[model samples]
Target: MNAEAARTPLFDEHVALGAQMTEFAGYLMPMQYIGIKQEHLAVREGCGIFDLCHMAQLRVFGTSAFDFLQYLMTNDLSRLSVPGMAQYTLICDDDAGIIDDVIVYRTGEIEYLLVANAINRRVVFDWANMIRDRWSTHQPCGESAPRQGIDLEIVDETDRTGLIALQGPLAIPLVEQMMPEGADIPTRFKILATTIGPTPVLLSRTGYTGEDGVEIFTHASNTAAIWRYLLSFPEISPCGLGSRDTLRLEMGYHLYGSDMDRGVDPISARLGWICPADKPDFVGSDAIRRIREQEDHRVLVFFTADDAIPRPGMSLSANGVEIGHVASGTYSPSLCVGIASGYVPTGYSRPGQKLDLQVRRKQVSVVVVDPPFVQGTSL
Candidate 1:
């Protein structure tokens, strides 16, 4: 591990379990407990627990919190009419370039919990603070003074909070076992203020893997206790970043740096669904609208190969001409094949298009398919 790398609250627990740790996004995280394939299969067939403390957690609250977020996020915040509703939204720059994809949980009428990717934590925090400061000081041109600046506060809770995910078909049942009697279990895409044992947590029915699960957020001090309790249920396996990557790849989910970045807009990334046209104008609304009107030069596509596994940076070509490079690639444990996603010319991004993937020494034939290489999971 790098000398500067940070460790999560469960680092000691992982070390004691003989997990292979690696530095990822400035955090020393478990790469694997036993093996990627074993952990991957565990989530597909049963349950897997993951330490997600590396991800950033931000809290936004106050009178103007809704308006502040409404102006910054591409998705409509009004959909969260009540508390405990979680929405996946994209934070974009003025030019509609994706800054980061985050999930916002409406924890209160004027408060929300935003969860962002670990690697983009600082970037998101800085950008949000800059915007918040500017928005708080803006005065109308005709007004003599700025109306009482919208009341708002953005707090970085990354260091003080710990996140854990219990994923798979058995995840909900296992969580229910720990819940107080008569406590309602949060349904998919929802959240609940609940307790496990004596520790209070914000439990949300969400996950990156294409499976049914819940992510629990609690005080950093309570993380290890929760992790140990979850693992005590013999059915739950401790998963690492390796299986997390493979599981998400099989579902055709996008990774921030790989599938998108400051240079890529949501329209070209096949994530336009998150940006509804009926919503009020936002920071990137104008730029996104322009991009949506024009034809996309390159579009993201998901593909699979039978004989060879695709790897990131591998060349993707067609008719003996290079088109693009693999953005994310991995061997799909469930499908028993290699699956990858990359950007290619819009003309060749259809589901049945054939492309050639340069897998090391040989060119392997690949077929562009609709998202989710593996199906019939417990999602």
Candidate 2:
């Protein structure tokens, strides 16, 4: 660990358990514990616990927080009007380029919380603050009085909070056991403030592994105890980033920097689903709408190889013509094959299209396939 890298509250526990540490997003985090393959299977077949305190948690509150977020984010916040509801949204720049993919939850009638990738948290915060400053000086008047204005507060609660991701098919059952009597776990994509073993926790049935699970958020001071409590169940295995990446790869979930960056347009990234068409004006909405008018030149595609492992930055070609490069790739322990995602020309983005992935100096045959290469997930 470096002298400047941030350490989560569970860093000591990870070290004690013999985790292979790595520096990611300015934090010293566990890359793996027992092994990547075993940990990956544990999450697929049973349950896996993850230390996710490195993620950022920002709270937005006040009378106009909802409207403020609607203008700043691509997804329609009106859909999450009810408390406990959550939605996956994209924060984009003025050119419709992806800034960060985030999940926002309505914690109260007028309060909301957004979780951003650790690397982009500060960027998102500064962007929001800049918008807030502009809105404060140029509040719309007359007919736009009730609707187009902003008076919200942003709070950075990341350092004060700790997060744990308990994921898999059996995750719900284990969490149910720890909840207080007469209190039921929230449904999918919902959140609830509840207590577990005397500690107050914000439990949300949300995960990146495409599995049914809950992310528990509590005070940083209580994370070690909560982590230990969750692991008391013999069926739960402690997993790290290595397994987490493989698991998400199997489900075709996008990682922030690898899959999409600020320079990438959301349409080409296949994240248009999160940006609804009927929403009012938002950041990059006009540009995105214009981009949708034209045919997408390149679109994200998924593929699998028989024996070769396709790694990031590998080139893909069709008939000796370069198409695109791999964005994220990994070996699927469950499928016993290599799975990868990359951008290709629209003509070659269809499922079943054949392409050659350049591995070292050799060309490896790969077939494009629709996502979720391994199905039957709890999601």
Q: Backbone clashes per model, in order?
A: 0, 0
C-alpha lDDT (0 to 100) for residue 102 of candidate 1: 98
> Least lDDT summed over 10 consecutive residues: which range in candidate 1?
138-147
lDDT of each: 0.92, 0.91
Question: Against the correct fold, how does model 1 do in TM-score?
Answer: 0.97
The residue pairs found clashing in candidate 2 are none
For model 1, give the RMSD to the true fold. 1.7
Compare the candidates by lDDT and give the number of the best one: 1
lDDT of 1: 0.92
RMSD score of candidate 2 (Å): 2.0
Which residue pairs in candidate 1 have backbone atoms (N, alpha carbon, C) closer than 3 angstroms, thus clashing? none
- Writing each residue's lDDT as its tens digit, candidate 1 over 1-379 gives 5999999999999999999999999999999999999999999999999999999999999988998898789989899999999999999998999999999999998999999999999999999998776656554242234547578889999999999999999998888899999899998889999997678999999999999999999999999999998888999999999999999999989999989999999999999999998775677888999898997578999999999999999999999999999999989999889999999989999999999999889999999999988889899
Best by TM-score: 1
